[model samples]
Target: MKKILAALVVLVTIGTGSYSYAASAEKAFARVEKSGTIRCGYFTWQPAFMKDPNTGTLSGINYDFMDKVGHFLGLKIEWAEEVGIGSVTEALGAGRIDVMCASMWPDPAKMFHTEYTLPTYFSAVYAIVRGSDKRFDGNLNSINKPEVKVCGIEGDITANASRAAFPQANFVGLPPTADGSQLILSVVSNKCDVMLGDAPLLIDYSKTAPGKIRKVAGVDPVHVFGEHLLVNKGEHHLKMMLDTAITTLVNSGEMDKVLDGYEGVYGAPEKAFKPLR
Candidate 1:
């Protein structure tokens, strides 16, 4: 009788554990459906996600895309919080936000903690240097030397790319909170000799600081990364829903229209590239 009681208790505990695991797996999607709102954690990157300081109005390619996505799903998108690029995964894992509406580069490191929806677009990464500097002009190999100083936002794609491409170069990593301007400043001040970034970001900065920086000419892009919306890992339902909505927008040309509206005004088509159909 004692053995039977112990066996029954063990089975009940195992069953309860399995039930809890299943509940946790669907928790994120269930919460969003129950609330009818998808809370967003966004990072502020120009032309991608931007916040108007005085009015607190949010506008940009990702902002518009997400708005349309919410409409398609019949759900409200709440701009719940602004997250730093480095800690975006942590924010998602903590349940502070339902999804990261901001378009992010899906690198291997980030894949560990997050699941990404279908890519909305692509961006080419370039090596940027001072405008007057010509050491690496035609010789891409010059920048890979140990003496070259590469600066990029800590934990960002550009920094990771640089480290991968130029193993011998010295890496100067800025805080995750550092912005494009800060990275540009690092190059301008000669704190770093080279920096890696997307063309749109470099062009935008060039507008403000003319003749300060220029991309290395006559070389292929360092890398091309697909930009994706991020959700916490294991939120398969949420990811599937988002992927469906994105495919609808892309196929119907609505996504292109959104990108067109921001072109020249916020760097699209020229700086950002649309995904190939």
Candidate 2:
């Protein structure tokens, strides 16, 4: 009995040490501390994120927020435009980027790969139709018919929502290569009849192609979508750090300042961003 107790105690000690090491290894914030930088990922979207047309400097609300986050964390920000909406989830799951502050919603489908921060903004699907295309109005019932070709990026909630909204409508899903801007351009160029996307993205579109295309109706009442930051799921420390950073920004008014700058530059009002409560 004494020998058996000794063996059990030895086993417990070994298990405890192994668990501690594994826990330390899985923590991404600790890894960041070791490396001394936060690897951030952004995407190609105006106002939220954009490569400045003249200076080539990256600018936007997301950029500003991330910069502030880096300062708060006492780490250097090494940012990159990593992937589009379609590929971002995969990039997070695979750990290609430590943090993605881009077009991500609190999509339950992505729960396995990432821990989403509190929402920073709200977006709704809007229908973009040519001013001259009178076939379909903005009404959901009218656009849900079989004849409408609703163009959207593949593998997005927008595409899913389009299908759900208009089961009879011929929903055309483009490859991930086609982003929000491309979807809008498709409609403007007559390649596609209608473009469906988040309101913010569509708002950006209306400005560029003024009077050519209009929001067919109004914002969809479907479950509103939003943008949230994502970190790998197992990285509890990283998640906590990011969450703290996000909360800090949202609280400090520094986030508001950055957002105001972007809003002014992009001609969007401060009300455009939906605070994550």
Please name the candidate that would achieve the greatest TM-score relative to the true structure: 1
Give the per-residue lDDT digits (tens) of candidate 1, residues 1-277: 2343234334544866653423556566768867888999988777787888899999888999998998887788999998888788889999999999988886778888899999887777788999998889877788988899998777667678778889899999988877677888899999999987777677677788888999998888887788889899988667867887899998898888888897776456433455453
| Error in Å for residue 187 of model 1 | 1.5
> Which segments of candidate 2 are over 4 A away from where they belong?
1-21, 24-27, 53-55, 134-138, 218-223, 264-277
Per-residue accuracy of model 2 over 99-206 as CA lDDT, tens digit each: 887646565666866788775655554677777776655465777777778876676665766777678888888786456677777787777787665545656766
| Model 1 stretches with alpha carbons more than 4 Å out | 1-24, 270-277
Write down the lDDT of every candidate, Cα atoms only. 0.80, 0.66
Worst lDDT run of 10 residues, candidate 2, spans 1-10
**Clash statistics: count for each candidate:** 0, 0
**CA RMSD for every model?**
8.2, 7.9
Number of residue pairs clashing in candidate 2, backbone atoms closer than 3 angstroms, sequence gap of 3 or more or interchain: 0
TM-score of 1: 0.87
